[model samples]
Each structure stands twice: as C-alpha cells, then as structure tokens.
Target: IEGPDLISKLRSEHGVSVPVLMLTERRELSDKIRAFRSGADDYVTKPFDIPELEVRLQAIVNRAQGRPATRRLTDGGLTLDLATLIASREGRQLRLYPGTRKLLQVLMRASPSAVSRQELEHALWGDDPPDRDLLRSHMSAL
Candidate 1:
C-alpha cells in the first residue's frame, strides 16, 4: 500500500494516537495534501536532510507524548505558557483578550523576526480577514 493509504489505515485503527510522518519520493503538492488529509503529522520528500528529518521526528514524538516543543517561552522577564495560553511579564500577569492572545502567540513564535502586517492578519483570520488596521487594535491590547 502507498504512504497515504498506510496513514489512513493507521488513523482508522489508532485514532490519531499514533503520529505518522510520511517520508516519500513523491514531491507533488497533491500528494502532500493527500497525505495530510489522510492524517499525517508531517511529510518529507526524497533527498531530505538527516538533521531536519530527525528534528521533525522529535517534534512529532513530542506532540504525540502531549509535550509541546516549547511549553513556555522565556526571554528575560517575559514568559508565555504555550499550552495554557497564560502570559506574564515582569512578575505581572497580563489579561490577554482572545485576539490579543493569538497575536501574541504568533509574535512570540516569530521572535526577533520581522512579521509583516499581512502575515499577522492572515494568522488571526485566514482568507476573510477583517478590514482596516484592526490588527493594530489587537497589538495595542497585547
């Protein structure tokens, strides 16, 4: 059976308890999408880098074991618990609204990297995004 078929079988039998990473020779977008739709956690094509593959396997294991790759991100006096969506800075708890919390999560994950306004909006609301500079409002609250 093919990789996607195998993934579908595993998902049906185990119900997502097993993390499936597809390492295949097919590099087409349709093939990748089919694997994901069949319940693959990750996919890598042929001629892959060993280090990158190992990292992806570790990430899948972490997710399957109920341990996030980064449970809490700490930089100086700030901390954000990714699992619980709790955040604090300088020994003070922050009351983050839903939009603000999402924005913070995206920003924290892309720390030190410049995130475009368009990317932020897409992250918050894909395709049918809000009009105007509404992301600014979320940023202010954050």
Candidate 2:
C-alpha cells in the first residue's frame, strides 16, 4: 500500500501542530513549495550552514513553544478557548475531567473534520496504547 506524504501524514493523520523544519537534499522550488504547502514551518535545502541550520531550528522551536495562535473555536453553543484549554457551552463552563478536557482540546482543534483514531490515540496515549479500548472508553465518557 502507498503511504501518504511525510508532512501530510504528520499534520493530517497524526494531528501534529508543532512547527516543522524540513532539511532535505532536494533544491527544487516545487519541493520547497510542496513542503510549505504541506504544513512545514520552514525548509532548508541541503549543504546548509551548520550555524544557520541551528538558528533556524531554534527559531521554529521557540515559535512552537511561544504564544499559541489566538484562536477561539466555536460550534453551535459550544465554545473552546484553545490557548486557555477551556471549554464551555452556552457561556457556562463545563466541568470535565482532566482527560476529557484534554480530549476536548484535541477535538475542538480538529473541528469541522473527523479526527483519525490514530490521532486520538496519540493524544490519549503518547506511544503506548493499553490493550483494552481505553481511548474509546474515554471518548464515551465525553
């Protein structure tokens, strides 16, 4: 089976919102554009200066950890403040468990489109998934 592109898989399939710096040997403009359009925060062709590469990587890291996008997502009567990790419905704060809150954060950010089970599993469990249907249980709670 053919797998998706690296950036596309990471962003669309894995729900990775962090900054990405592409260091590739390809120098074609099309490659650069494809990377950017695929959600790469920055791209550096091969034969890059060590110092410049370090600086660029650092810049992306700082940006990733710095102020988040001032985005407030809402649907119907539900409200989500991404920067604050707060969710409410009809102006009343919803008392959600920590895991549920985290789940909502992921869900709200992935709004208008269904988030893949792989992505949800990533959010629920970084790299290790319990043998049981733990993610489904948490989702059911929410």
TM-score of each: 0.55, 0.49
| lDDT minimum window of 10 residues, candidate 1 | 50-59
Question: Model 2 over residues 27-129: C-alpha lDDT tens digits?
Answer: 8888788888888899888788754664466467657879444446688888876545567999998877767766776787677789988888777677886
Candidate 2 backbone collisions, by pair: none
Mind giving the per-residue lDDT tens digits that candidate 1 earns over 1-142?
9888877987788675578888889989999999999998999998997546755775788788888786677767888776566789997888988788778767876887889988899878887788747888888777
- Positional deviation of 47 in candidate 1, in angstroms? 40
TM-score of 1: 0.55
Model 1's number of clashes is: 0
- Candidate 1 global lDDT: 0.80
Residue 17, candidate 2: Cα error in Å is 16
